[model samples]
Every structure is written in C-alpha cells, then in structure tokens.
Target: MLKTFRWAFAVTGLGLVAGVLYDGWTALGLVAVLAVLEVSLSFDNAVINAGILKKLNAFWQRIFLTVGILIAVFGMRLLFPVVIVSVTARLSPPQAVHLALTDKARYQELVTDAHPSIAAFGGMFLLMIFLDFVLEDRETKWLGPVERPLARLGRIDMLSVCVALGVLLVTATTFAVHAHQHGGGHADKAQTVLVSGIAGLITYLIVSGLSDFFERRLADEEAGGHAGQHSEDAGTGRPAVALAGRAAFFTFLYLEVLDASFSFDGVIGAFAITNDIVLMALGLGIGAMYVRSLTVYLVRQGTLDDYVYLEHGAHYAIGALALILLVSIRYEINDIVTGLIGVAFISASFSSSVRHNRAARR
Candidate 1:
C-alpha cells in the first residue's frame, strides 16, 4: 500500500510539473480539475477492469500497467483529438495541429461543436458492450433459437466487426445528406465522416478481435487440459507456451481497446475545459494517471472478488454512459454529471461490498 501510494504520488507530481512547465498555473489548475474528474468518473471502469484482470495471466498484468499508460497518455491525449479535428472540423492535419497550438480559443469552440458526433460514437460503442453483456447473462431457451444462429455467424467478435462497419456507412451517409441539405459542400463532409468512422471502426475491430482470439485460445487450452490427464501433462508444456503468447497479445489489445473507449469521452470532454493543445494534453494526461492508478489499485486490492456485484454495477454504469453519449449527440450533458453518475454507482457498490464482507465474517 505504501508503495502504491508512492507510485501514484510520483506520477501525479510528474504530471503537475509537466503542466506547470508547459502552460503554467492555469494549466496546473485545469490538470487538478481533470484529475478529480477522472478519479470520479473512472471508478466503474476500474471495477470492470478488475474482473478482466483477474482472468489475465501475470505477464499480461504487467503490460496492462505499463504499456497501458503510454496508450492513455499519447494515443488518447495527443493523437485522438487531432484525428477528430481533421475528420469532423475539415481541418488539415497540420492545420488542426496549428489551430490546437496557436488558436486555442477558436479551436475549443470548434471541438465543442463537434461534441454531438463524439457522443454518438461513444454511445453506440457503449450500447454494443451493454447488449453483449445482456445477451451473455440471459439463459433462456427461446432466445437461443435466434441467438444460436447469430452466435454461429462466426462469434460475437465477427458480429461486432460487422456492426461497426455498418455504423460507419450509415453515419457517413447521414452526415453527407445533412450537409447537402444544409447547402454545405457534401463531398468534403462525406469523405471526412467516411474516413474517420472507418478508421475508428477498424481500430476497434482489430483490438477487439485480437482480444477475443486470445481469450478463446486460453479457454480452449484450459478445457483441453481437463479432458485427459496424461495428455494434459504432455500438452501442458505446449499449453504454457501458447498461454504466454496469447496473454501478451491480449494485454496489448486490451489496453488499446480500453484507451480507445476512454478516449471517446476524455477527448470530447477535454474540449469543454480548454482547447489549447498543451493545456488539454496536460489536463487529460493528469487525469489518465489517476485512472491508471485506479486500475492498478483495483487489481491489487482484488476489489472484484471482494464485491461480486461491483462488476455488475460497473457494467450498468457503462450502459448509462453509452446512453448519455448517444443523447449528447443531440443535447449537451455536462461532464461533471457524467462523472458523478459513475461515482455514485461505484460508491454504492463499495458500500454493498463492505456489508457483504462484514456478513461473511460474522
């Protein structure tokens, strides 16, 4: 615990120093606020992640803590917003970069205006996650008539890819039609939406597919081992090798997917606070540290096992966030409120977990 606190403080202190150097006191304040927001909002994510982490091998665990940080800091904080600006705002990559750096004020306005689309992306993604979880839980025979066929349609992994692609096509067409009806240039809008949506979808598909592949492989290995003890021992050596390979791949994919999911909100929300690229980066980067530390804390504390319902609560929060993101496409939802909802659910779960522990002890 002492070591963990030291690490958290060290990383936070580093972020503070970086913010001060990059954008001074104002940036520092923004970072502080972002840190608080991230801590509050990401408890649900931590809970969900804890459940996943328990299933992962030790090697993957280390990668999640280390490489995951890089993805959050660089991929989400720096690259993601640039991609959004280039695609939706019709800014060239270089121009967007310049706008973010030089015309920070106007850039913020542009990004804020782009919130609807960002929210749409997050909402749909979360909806997919929620739906998948629901399908996994319900054990009804009637649904199997419909689900078995879909399940046989090459796994949920493949289904997700198809859904993501379909969404990209639909979103691009809708945006293009809207642009044309509004007397704006439809070609640019169509191209931008198509390209960006495809890019995001492809990233999601690749990461999710890879993660599923590894998880399935691990399960297969375990199942095969239980079938024949003699063969299992002989196969044990091979299984260990296979397990290590799969774990490494899964860890990389998990971090990438998680970072992408988190970015859907973090990048959009950052615009609400500041548009200065440096300030936005500083603020969100600090927030990322807290999220990462929280992930580690969940792992170390075995929070999921201690609180059986915690994962369920986190998934519920994820479902809510997804709905909120979808609504934000047409409406404005404050980031503070989003954060609070997640925090409230997590707090309730924690209280429940404490009661459970006490009851078990008695």
Candidate 2:
C-alpha cells in the first residue's frame, strides 16, 4: 500500500511546502483542509475507478496513472472550472483566467452561479451509473433488500432511462424553477436544467455503452467460441490483455467523464474554503492524486474481489451522491453531510463483507 501511494504522499509534502511559500501558514492550512475534504468526499470515486481499471489493459492502466491523473488534476479541477466561468460569464478563456487571477470574488460567484446546470448534468450522469448497477441482473447482492427490487424492476426495458428522465423532468419543473426565482431569474430555468440533465444522460449512455460494447468485443476475441473472456480473465486473476486500442480509449474517456461527474460539486464547494483558484487547484490536485493512487492499489491488489461488497458500497455511495447533487440544485447541503453519508455507506458495506468472509471461513 505504501509503495502504491508513495507518489501521493510525496506530492502532499511538496504541495504543503509550495502552499506556505506561495502565501503563509494560513494558505497551507486551507490547502490541507481542501485536500482532506476531497479525499473524504471522493473515496467512493477511487473504488469505482478501480472496478473499471482492472478490466483495462496494463498499458491503459499506465495511461490512467499518467495521462488520466493529469486530466483529473489539471483538466477537471482547474481548466474545467475556468471553462464554466468563461462560458457563463461571457469571457474568453484568457479573460476567464484573468478574472480568476484578478477578481477572485467575481470568479467564485460566477462558478457558484453556474452550479445549477453543473448539478443537473453531473447528477443525471451519476444517477444513470447507480441505476444501471442496481438494476442489472446480478447475484452479488450487497443490499438485497433494495437491490433485489431494483433488479426485479430491471425487467422493464428502458426502466432506468424512464426513471432518470422522469426524475429530471420533475426536478426541472420544481427545484429548477425555484432556483430560477432565487438565482437571478435566469431566462429559462426549466429549459436549461432539462437540457443539461439530458446531456448528462446522453453522455452516460454513449460513454458507458461504447465502453461495454468494446469490452464485450475483446471478451469474444479472447474466448473464441465460448462465453465472455472478460469473466474468464477475472476467474484466472488476470486482466484481459486485449483491453487496448479503441477499447482502451473509450474506457479512458469513460473514466475521465466519470471523474468529471464526481468533481463538479467539489470544485464549486471549494470556494467556501478559499476563493483562490490557484490554491483550490493545488489543494484539490494533491487530493486527486491520492484518489488515483488508491484506485491503482485497489486494482493491483484485487481488493474489490476480496472485499466483495466494497463495489456495492461504492455504487450505493454514488447513488447517494447523485441524489445529493440533484437536491443541491435547490438546497445547500454542507460538505460535511456529503462526506459523512459516503463514509457511512462505505463503512457499512465493509462490515458486511467482513461478516460474509467470517461465515465462509466457518
């Protein structure tokens, strides 16, 4: 574990020193707090990433550790927020940078103001992930009480889509409208929210759909005339060496989009801690590195296979996070509440897995 996470620790040390050099101990303190906030809120993200990363080829896994980490740290944490402010504030990219560097308060306000659309999009995308997971026909029931019913309901074709769309529409009309009234009366609250929500749903469908399709193709090639070699590879405790080329690309893209969905809330919430974009990026970037390292550790160690229920807990956490994002369109949920809810679900699932293992030992 220490070997897997050495870089994250190194980065943490370097980032703390850089923070102090950049400002003072107060800046260092805020950076530390932000890093903790990110890790606490995103441990489930690392678990989910591990589940997907294991299926990927080693080459791609390297890419995830390399290029993917760069994207997560700089692309999502820094540039994406700038892009949001640019588009929403009607400024060019350079101008957005200037605004962020110059008028931190205005930049923060614009980013927070754009939260409604960001929430709609990220919420729907994550909701699709959780819905498909729970609705899939699988026997590895972590919470059989809830997952069993969800699986039964999966019998209805397009049920997940229907439910997601219904939720989006209802939310657009209700919470979104209320937001419009309170949120400076944006020209078309329902329209903006509905459109962003649909975009998110479509994104999930395309990215996840293509990834599964390519992976299935890889499995067939490996198994020849038999069933999925993806499963066969898993049974043998080896990655499907063929998860490269197009399959790797889409899987990589899927990971990035997934990271983006996980990051929207965190980026906006960082303003509460400190309005400095550079500090926010530095702090959040350090935390993101740890999540990435944790993901790699989970994959190499096959922790998901050992724990069994850990993935279920992570998905449940995703479901909870999705709902929180959606609800945040109207309400202001504290970062602490968000972090605690995820921790509770993950902790409970870990306990359950421990019990299951003990019973098997008997």
Candidate 3:
C-alpha cells in the first residue's frame, strides 16, 4: 500500500511545502483540507474507474494513467472552470483566466452562477449510469433483491430513459413553480437545467453507443481472423475488451466523460471552502492524482474481484450522488453529507463481502 501511494505522498509533501511558502501556514492547512475533501468525495469514483480500467489493454491503461490524469487534473479541475466561466459570463477564455487570477471572488461567483446547469448535466449523466447498471441482467448479483427487481423492470423498452426523463420533468416543474412564486425570479434556471440535463443524456447515449459500435466491429474482426479467440483478454469475466484502436479511443472518451460526471459536485462543493481558483486547482489536482493512482492499484491488486460487492456499492453511491446533485440545484446539501453517503454505501458493501467470504470459507 505504501508503495502504491508513495507518489501521492511525495506530491502532497511538495504541495504543502509550496503552500506554506506561498501563503504561510493557513494556505498549507487549506490545501491539506481541500485535498482530503476531494479524496473522500471521490473514493467511489476510483472504484468505478478501476472497474472500467481493468477492461482496457496495457497501452490504453498507460494512457489512462498518463493522459487521463492530465485531463482529470488540468482539463477538468483548472481549464474546465475557466471554460465554464467564459461561456456563461460571455467572456473569452483568456479573459476568464485573468478574472480567476486577479478577481477570484468574482470568478467564484461566475462559477457558482453556472452551477445549476452543471449540476443538471452531471446529475442526469450519472443517473443514467446507475439506472443502466441496476436494470441490466448480470450473472453476478451483489444486492440480488434490489437488482433482480430492477432487471425485471429493464425488460420494458427504454425504461431507464423514461425514468430519467420523468425525474427531470418533475425537477423542472418544481423549480419553475418555485421561481414563479418568487415573482418570476430565476425563471431561466428551469430552462437551463432542462436543457443541460438533456445535453448530458444525449452525450452519454452518443459516447456509449459509439463505444458499443466500435467494440462490436472489433469483435467481428477478431472472430474472422482467429477462431476460438475471445474478445476480452483471458481473465475474470467483465465486459469483452474493446480491442480495436477506434474502439479503444471511444472507450477512453467514455471514461473521461464518466470521470467528469463524477467531478461536478466536488468542484462546486470546493467553493464553500475558498474562492481561490489556483488553490482549488492545486489541491484538487493532488487529490485527482491520488484517485488515479488508487484506480490503478485497485485494478492491479484485483481488489474488485476480491470485494465483489464493491462495484455495486459504488454504482449505488453514484445513484445517490445523482439524486443529491439534482436536489442541490435548488436545495443546499452539505459536502460532508454527500461524502458520507458514498462512504456509507461502500462500507456496507465491504462489510457484506467480508461476511460472504467468511461464510464461504466456513
């Protein structure tokens, strides 16, 4: 475990030293708190990431560690907020960057202004993931009672989509009525949430559909070339490996989108601590690196196989997060509460798995 986290520790040490030098002990403490907050909020994200990472080939795995980390750290944590502020505030990206540096309070305000839409998009996307997982027929059942019933419902055409759309409609209607009651204030917020939610759903469909298409093509090609060849590398049965170059590309894209969906809440919650973008980026970047490292470690250690219910717990946590994100659009939930929900689910699942293992041994 120490070996796996050696780099994370090193990075944290350097960040703390830099933080202390830059702004004295307070900055150092803030960075430490932010990093810990990010890690706690994102532990389930690492588990889900590990589940996906196990399916990719070696080269793609390396890309996830290298290129993917870059995206998670810089692209999402730093550039993403800038892009959001720029687009929403009608400023250029460079101008947004300037604002972030020179006028952080205002920059934080702009980002907060955009949170309704961000929450809508991210929440819907994550909701679809959880719904699809629950609704799918799986050979291995973790929470069989809940899952079996959901799988039965999955037999209905587009049931997951239907459920998501219904929830979105209710959310929009509720908010729209609320805004109207408040003298038509924030009337546009409902529209923004609806549009953003649809956009997220569309993005998920397109990415997952493209990935499936490419994966099928690759499987066909492999079958034609080599008889008795498996689509996945010989291992514990997950989904078939997406082996074709194009398929791998799409799969990587899907993974990035998935990660982004998981990040929306954490990014917004960080604002409660401080409005300094530089500090937020640096602290969150350190946490993101540790999450990525944890993903790799989980995959390499076959932790998912050992803790069979862990992935199920993570997915359920995603479900909880999706709902929480949507609700947070109107009602404020403490970040600590959000983090605890994930932790609680994961803890319960881990405990259940241990009991199962013990019973099997007996």
Candidate 4:
C-alpha cells in the first residue's frame, strides 16, 4: 500500500509546501483540510472505480492511471468549475479565470448559484447506478434482506428510471414551493433543475448502455459464440481477458462519466472549506490522484474478491450518496454529514464481510 501510494504522498507534500509558499500557514492548513475532505468523501469512489477497472484491459487500465488522472485532476477539478462560472455568469473562459482570480467571492457565488442544477444532474445519475446494482438479481447477496427485495423489484422494466423521475419531480416541486415562499417568483429555476436532472439520466443511460453493448460484443469475440452466451465471464466476478478496441474505448468513457458523478459533491463541498479555485484544485487534485492510485491498487490486490462484501458496501454508500445529493436540492446538508453517512454504510458492510469470512474459516 505504501508503494502504491508513494506518489500520492509525494504530491501531497509538494502541494502543502506550495500552499505555504503561495500564501502562508493558513493557506497550507486550508489546503490540507480540503485534501482530507476530498479523500474522506471519495474512498467509496475508489472502490467503485476498481469494480469497473478490473474488467478493463490492462492497456485501458494504464490509460485510467495516466490519461484518466489528467482528466480527473485538471479537467474536472480545475476547468470544470471555471466553465460552470463562465456559462452561468455569461463570461468567456478567460474572463471566468480573471473573475476567479480577481474576485473570488463573485466566482464562488456563481458556482454556488449553479449548484441546484449540478446537484440534480449528479443526483439522478448516481441514483440510477445504486438502483441498478441493488435491484439486479445477483448470485452473491451481501445484504440479502435489502438487496433480495430490490432484486425482485428489478423485474419491472425501467423501474429505476421511473423511480428517479418520480423523485426528481417531487424534489423539483418542493424546490418550487420553497422558491415561492422566498419570493423568487420564477419557475425557471425549477425548469432548469428538471432539465438538468433528465440530462443526467439520459447521460447515464447512454454511457452504461453503450458500455454493456460493447462489452457483450467483445465477450462474444473472445468466446467465439453469440453474445451473452458466456455472460458470467463478462462480469468481473470471473477471470477475463482484456477487451479490445471499441470495447475498451466505451469502457473508458463509462469510467470517466462515473468519476464525474462522484466528483460533483467534492467540487461543491470544497467551497465550504475555501473558495480559492487554485487552492481547491490543488488540494482536491492531490486527493484525486490518491483515489486513482487506490483504484489501481484495489484492482491489483484483488481486494474485491477477498472482501466479498466490500463492493456491496461501496454500492450501498453510493445509494446513500445519491439520496443525499437529491435531498440537498431541498435542504442544505453539511459535507461532513454526507461523508459520515457513506462511511457508516461502507463500514457496516465491511464488518459484515469480516464476520462472514471468520465463520467460513471455522
């Protein structure tokens, strides 16, 4: 683990020094706090990434480590918020950068003002992932009491979609009511929220659907038979060879989208610690690197197979996170509360797995 995370440690050390050099001890402290916040909030993200990464080809795995890191650190953490401020505040990208540098308060306000749409979109996308995982009938049952019933309900086609849409509608309506009470006197905010939520749902469907389609094609190519003939081998549960070409491409895209969903909370939450975009990027970017390294480490170590319920824990954490994101649209939730809920669920699942392992040993 030390070897795997050596770069993370190094980068974090450098970031702290740079923070101090850039400002002072206060800046360094804030950067450190932001990094810890990101790491705490995203441990489950690493687990989920490993679950997907293990199925990818080694070449693709390398890309995730290399190219994926760039996207995560620079693309999402730095450029994304700038772009959000640009579009929302009607400024060019360069002007957005200037605003971020010249007027941190205005930049932060713009980003925060855009939070509702971001929350709605990310919430819907993540909700779909959790629902699909729990609602699928799988051979392994981590939390059978909860998962078994959900799996049975998965029989209803597109039930997750229906549930997500219903939830979005209710949430949006609640927001509208609150807006009226506050005298915003406009439905545009609610409209934007609904549209963004639908876009997220659509994005999830496209990415996941394409990934599933390509995975089947690749599996068939390897098995030399009709697609789905070797369904079990297609999943990460079984030993599998690397996917080629198009399959690898789609899988990579899927991973990026998944990472984006996980990042939404971190990006928004970072403002709570400090509104300095550069600091936010530096701190969160350091944590992002660690999360990526953790993903690769988990894949290499085969942690999922050893701790059978770990993936269950990660998925359940995701479910909780999704719910939290949705609820945040209606009420303000502290980032710490979000982090603790995820930790609680994942820790319980881990404990359950340990007990299961001990019993089997006997």
Candidate 5:
C-alpha cells in the first residue's frame, strides 16, 4: 500500500530527474506526455498481463518486474532504435549515433518517415493476433474446422515470426522497385531495408522462441518434481512443492514479448517527437515506467478476471496495433492518435465487462 506507492514515486522521480539532467525541461515534458500515452494505450496490455501473472510463482514475478525493466529500458529504448537506424537508414553505426545526437531534427524526420514500415510490421503482427483470437473464441463459431487449424497455426506468438518475415520481403521488393522513383542515388538502400527487416524478424524469433522453450522446460521439471514429491509423501509423508514454476517462467517470457511489442511503437513514435537521442530515450523511458506500473496495478486489482471482455479488448487492440503498424509503412501516425484508438477500444471493452459482471450478479 504505502510502501508500494512510495516505491512507485521513487522510481518515477528517479526517472524524471534522470530525464531532466539528460535533456532538460523540454525532454521532461516529452517524457510526461509519452508516459501518459503509453499507459492509456496499454491498459488492455496490463489486463492481459495480469491474467498471465496470476499463473506465475512469486520468484518469477520479482524477476519480471526487475530484470524485465532492464530489458525494456536499455534493450528496447537504446539498442532497438540504433539497430533500426543502422539497418534501415544505411547509416554506419558511428554515423547513426552522430545523426541521432547532432543532427537531431533530421534524424527525427528520418524516423517519422520510417513509420510506414513500422506500421506495416505492427499491422501484420496484430492481424495474426486478431485472427488467432477470433479462431479461439469457442462461443463465437466463426470459422469452425477451418478456424481451428488456422487458430492452431496462428497462435499469435508463433505466427508473428512468419508475418515479420513476410513484411521484410514485401518491404525489400517495394524499396527496390521504387528506388528509382524516389531519386535512387543509394543503391544500397534496398539491401539495407532487406537486411534490417530480416535481422529484426530473426531477432524476434530467436528471443521469443528460446524464451518459450526455456519456460516449457522449466514447467516440465516443476511438474515432475511435484509428482515425485507427491509419491514420496504418500510413502514418507512429505509435503509436495507446487508445480507452477514453469507457468511462471512462461508468463514472464510472455510479458517480455509483450513489452517488446509495445515498445516498438513507442521507440519509433518517440523519434517522431524528438531526434535528440537522449530526449527520445528519456521521454520514452518515462512512458515505459507508467506502462509497467499500470500493468502491475491491473494484476493487483484482478482487472482481467473481473472484466472478462478486457482480454478480448486487448487482443482487439493488438489487432488495431497491427493495422496501425501496417499503415505506418506508408504514413505518419501520430502517437496520440494511436494511443487514443487503443484506449477507446479497451475502455469500451471494460465497460462491457462491467455490465456483464453486474448482470451476472443479478
């Protein structure tokens, strides 16, 4: 209660101070706005995370909040953009850094210009999520036998890799064919886009797949240990440990993936706001904290279970995010607009969930 509030404030304060020191008042304001937008847009994400978190053991929960923070802050915030700049923009590593730091204005323009591709990535990604959800909802008999197979294949996590690859291929071909039309001096631009897209997809696949495998293995071990202890207890009267370790591990992994997915839009969007790398990082980092805290709050409150349609809303948001990303490949999407769209859908779902709960009570 008080302790948690204190901790949250302390963490936020630290982030603000750091942001101010790094980039001053303008940076701080950006951080504040981004934080609000992220939190609002990701309420559904928090609800979904809460449902998963309930299944995890306490140990893994702590790891998720701590280590997961590091990954989000450093990995997604710093490294992700650099990778994008190098791979997509054809800037050498050093040159990219220089552009981000010194030529902040131009760098931001470049990032904004890249939104169509980002939107494309997200749009395709969300489509897979939406399709999978549609197939899984037994109550709504949409696809039947065909639905089941596609549902099985389109498990959002698994299908994301293929979608990403597809996006890369399409982007590569489009860039190659349109290069001359765009005033084609840089022959390597198409190659860079192709390579970067492939790299991003590969990175997503490896990280997500390995995380899933490790979680499954941990779960199996925990199950076996529980069973062994149960048998021993029957003969020797020993208490058995719970077999939920693996579940927790997997939940953590899922949360990480979710975080990564959410951050992609933020990182790209932040660039549109400011090219000052430090400012962009500070602003987005603050936004990350709000999203993280909101996620924890949703878990603590049992928001997902209490609001049944919340998960549905989140999946829907995922669908929208996918669409937004796809569109971004060709247009500049304002973060405010993106955040509002997700928030609106989630809010509607939440209201529906509340109504259903009341009806159930009656």
Candidate 6:
C-alpha cells in the first residue's frame, strides 16, 4: 500500500506545504478539510475507474496516471467551474476568473446558483452508468432479487435510456412546479434542467456508444477472424486485453467524462470550505491524486476480481448519488449525508464479498 501511494503522499505533502505558505495555518487547515472531503466523496469513483483502467495497456495506464491526473487536477478542478460560471452568468473566462479571485463570495453564489443545471447533466450521466450496470445480465448478481428483474427488463432495447428519460422528465416537472411556487428566477431553472438533462443523456449515449463500438472491434480482432465471437468483452466489462490504437482513445475519453461527472458535486461543494480557487484546486487535486493512485493500485492488485461484489457496491453507490443530485435541484442535501451514503453501500458490499469468499472456502 505504501509503495503504491508513494507519489500521492509526496504530492500531498507538497500541497500542504504550499497551502501553509500561501495563507498561514488557516489555509492549511482548510486545505486539509477539503482534501478529506474530496476523497470521502470519490472513493467509489476510484473503484469504477479501476474496472476501466485495467483494460488499457501499460502505456495508456501511465497516461491515465500522468496526463489524466493533470486534466483532473487543472481541467476539472480549476477550469471547469470557471467555464460553467462564464456560460451561466454571461461572463468571459477572464471575468469569471477575476470574479473568483477578487469577489469570491459572489463567485461562489454564481457557481452555487448554477447547481441545478450541473446536477441535471451530471446526475443523468451517472444515472445512465448505474442503469447500464444494473440492467445488464451479468453472471454475478449482488442484489439478486432486485437486479434479476432489471436484467430481464434489459431485453427491451434501450430500456435504460427510456428509464433515464422518464426519470429526468419527472424530476424536471417536479422542479418546475416547485420553482413556479417559489418564484425563483421565473422558471428559467426548469428549462435549464430539461435542456441539461437531455444534453447529459445524449452525451452519455454518444461517448458510451463510441467506446463500446471500438471495444467490440478490438475484441473481434483479438478473437482472430472469429467475428461471431462476442458482442463485448467478457469478465471485466471492458476489452479483454489492454486496448490500443482507436479503442484506447475512445475508452480513455469515456473514463475522463465519467470522472468529470463524479467531480461535479465535489467542485461545487468545495465552496463550503473556501472559495479560493488556488487552495481549492490544490486540496482537491491532492485528493484526486490519491483517487488515481488507488485506481492504479486496484488494477495492479486484482482486488476487484477477488472481492467480486465491490463493483456492484460502487455502482449502487453511484445510483444513490444520481438520485441525490437530482433531488438536490429542488432541495439542498448535506454534503456529509451524501458522502456517508456512498460509504455505506461500499461497506455493505465489501462485507458481502468477504462472506461469499468465506462460504466458498467452506
């Protein structure tokens, strides 16, 4: 464990040192809190990522740890929120950055105010992921009673899409009525939710579809002229071998988008700690580093195969998060509460995995 996390520890130390140098002990304290918040909220993300990372070869895995980490740190942590605010509040990139640096309180307000749309898009994307997993007819069934019926329903073409659209429409309608009653921004938020949710759904379909298409091609090639072999990779739900060429590229894109969806809430919730973009990036960046490292470690160690049910737990946690995000559009949900819900699912799944292992031994 120590060997795997050596880089994370080193970078975390540097971030903490920089935090103290930037603004005394108070900034250091805030950075520590923010890092904890990020890690707590994102452990399940690491699990899901590991399941994908193992499909890539050493080169792409290195890229994930190196280039992917940079994007997660700078692109999502620092720049993405700026872009969101710029689009939402009609400010330019420079102006958004200026507002963040100069008037952090107002900037935080703008970012927070944009939460409905962010939640809509991210919530729908994540819901699709969870729905795909739950709806698939996998050999392993964690929640057999619930998942079994869902798998039967998966026979219906695009059942997951239909379910996702149904949920989005209902949620948007609920929010539209609530916003009308409250007179918050005159129903603009309802429209934003509907638009963003459709965007999210479409984005998921395109990216995921492209990734699966490439993976099928890769799988076909690996099967050696046996085009009738399999529609998708077996076992890991990714390509059988480490993907290369076009396959790796699309899969990598999918992983980044998935990671971004998970980070949406964290970026917004970090304002509860401090609105200083620099400190927020430094702290959450540290946590992201740890999450990336943990993912690589899981891929290297074959932990998922051993645990078996861990993936199910992570997906269930993701489903919970999706619901929470949509619900929070009309009502605020505490960050601590959100974090605990994920941790609970993961813990329960881990315990179940251990029991299954013990029974097999018997």
Summarize candidate 4's per-residue lDDT along 5-102 as a digit string, tens digits. 88788889988898888878889888888888888999999999999999976788889978998898899999999999898888999999999999
lDDT of 3 by residue, 1-362 (tens): 78767777887888788778877888887888888888999999999989988877889888987899789878988899999999998899999999998998889888877887898899999999999999999987888888899899999989999999998888777753353222225557788889999999999999988988888877776775488755555553433443577898998899899999988887898899877777787788788879988988999899999988999999999999999988877788899999999999999999988988899899
Please, what is the whole-model Cα lDDT of each candidate in the order they appear?
0.65, 0.88, 0.85, 0.86, 0.63, 0.90
Clashing pairs in 4: none
Clashing pairs in 1: none
The lDDT, on a scale of 0 to 1, for candidate 5 is 0.63
Per-residue lDDT tens digits for candidate 2, residues 120-149, read 999999999999999997878987888888
Best by lDDT: 6
Give the alpha carbon lDDT tens digit for every residue of 6-120 in model 6: 9899989999999999989898898889899999999999999999989988888888988998999999999998999899889999999999999999888888888888999
Judging by TM-score, tell me the better candidate of 1 and 2. Answer: 2
Count clashing pairs, candidate 3. Answer: 0
Q: What is the lDDT of residue 302 in candidate 1?
A: 78
The C-alpha stretches of model 4 lying farther than 4 A from their native spots are 179-184, 225-243
Clashes of 2: 0
Better of 1 and 6 by lDDT: 6
Question: Where does candidate 5 stray beyond 4 Å?
Answer: 1-5, 89-95, 113-117, 120-122, 138-251
Q: What is the lDDT of residue 180 in candidate 4?
A: 27
TM-score, candidate number 5: 0.75
Q: At residue 305, what lDDT does model 2 achieve?
A: 91
